[model samples]
Target: NPLMQPNAIEKISYGIDEAVKATGLGRTFLYERMASGELKSIKVGGRRLIRVADLMDFLQNAANQRIS
Candidate 1:
């Protein structure tokens, strides 16, 4: 059942390194977006993790912007 969920919903959150890998963006770029409030993330202990849903939404929004 673990593999049955859509990738978008499968993951709860991803650390900065995983987020950068998943988004194909540089660490600095993601950090900047996090600081700018353009992207949403949660602090788990001392680590900041981006929600999978938020990451997907951000990518979709970026695509829509390019099409516009």
Candidate 2:
């Protein structure tokens, strides 16, 4: 009990660096996608954040395209 770790909190959004780490995609590529409107992101103050749902949707759509 004392040594047990707490459950990790799921992230609702990720900054550019966090997204890169989560997806293993390069920063340039991610920025390109954002610029092209393939991937959606929001500007919060000075930070750009990508919603987890949007990221998942982007990956799922890509997979579907590959399958088709």
* Per-candidate TM-score against the hidden true structure: 0.81, 0.87
Cα lDDT of model 1 by residue, 1-68, tens digit: 55665554466789999998887999999888889988898998999999999988888888999999
Candidate 2 per-residue lDDT over residues 1-68, each given as its tens digit: 32464676768999999999999999999999999999999999999999999999999999999999
The CA lDDT at 43 in model 1 is 95
Q: Which residue pairs in candidate 1 collide? A: none
Best TM-score goes to which candidate? 2
| Alpha-carbon RMSD of each model | 3.7, 3.5
Worst 10 residues of 2 by lDDT: 1-10
Off by over 4 Å in 1: 1-9
> Which has the greatest lDDT?
2
